[model samples]
Target: MAATAVPTPPLLQISSTQPEPGSLVVEVDGEVDAASAPELSVALEPVWAAVSTRVVLDLSRVTFLGTAGLAELLRAADRADAAGVALRLVGGTRCVDRAIEVAGLAGRLPLSPDLGHAMHR
Candidate 1:
């Protein structure tokens, strides 16, 4: 008997842009889980490295965010704090909001209502 292969879900999509001189915005779509968190990390490491800049994560389009995803956000927040860079999350899907709330990070993570609000601050 041949063993059946487990089907993998769609990978997360990440796009990065420099909205201004000292700001970076990363947009995410699809599901982010243990398998896809590495991609998230790769996209975020540079933002973390660039000290004294603001980084905003746009997650309104995200369908799902798992524990790994939340972990990465926490790490980014820590790095942003240490580097003196502002970090913000714009747009919150139900999954993203629930995950953050469950992780007890509703206040810790800088969350903005929309891109316009995030950009202004």
Candidate 2:
């Protein structure tokens, strides 16, 4: 028998830009799992550190969202609440939506259909 290797998911990529003085838009792409949650957390550090009152996390590009990803998102919501930051999740795919819905966090996390909706809300 020959040995085989399993395929691994791509690493998560997080990027952020401040379009205005008090607002930030963060775009997340690729898979989010236990291996990538830390990257997400590190990327969010600026969100908490900055004076931005509003933050929009764009997840439409996310290909996968695992339990660890969900947990990180919940923690993000808590951190936002405690910090008095208005955090919104925008543009998620079915995979992302299913994970959140299955975890019963759809109601708890602020979700918007797009960037415009997120900014308006």
Candidate 3:
């Protein structure tokens, strides 16, 4: 009998909330590498599309962050701008916050320290 390879757990998991109509908060948890970027985009596209007020990307639970993850955020920012919807990202974990800080995207990505702050801004 051949030994079969076991599949790895999903690198990313996305959960979402809507505090109000046209407002969304999608929470990301897990690793976000080049491998998981596509899935991240797919998960975000609809939320971005449906938002009329704002979209808050809550990244408190994310365990890892990569350049690909940053790119996805940038794209989401662009989409939100084009659609006239506000986009804000809330920093949760230290590692994820550090990644965005190191990438110099804090200014450009509209990042906040918490969910309440992100929603109001």
| Number of backbone collisions per candidate | 0, 0, 1
RMSD of each: 3.4, 3.5, 1.9
Taking the tens digit of each residue's C-alpha lDDT, what string does model 3 give over 23-106? Answer: 998888888889988998999878766889998888888888899989998998899899898988888788788998899988
lDDT tens digits by residue: candidate 1, 1-121 = 9999999766799998887888888999888889888899998887777636788899988888899988888888898888898888975678888888878888998578898798788
Candidate 2: regions farther than 4 A off: 1-10
Q: Which stretches of candidate 1 lie over 4 Å from their true place?
A: 1-10
Q: What is the TM-score of each predicted model, taking all chains together?
A: 0.86, 0.87, 0.88
Error of 1 at 87 (Å): 0.2
**Root mean square deviation (Cα) for candidate 2:** 3.5
All candidates' lDDT scores? 0.84, 0.85, 0.86
What is the lDDT for 116 in model 3?
94
- Best model per TM-score: 3
Candidate 3, RMSD to the unseen true structure: 1.9
Better of 1 and 3 by TM-score: 3
Ranking by TM-score: 3, 2, 1
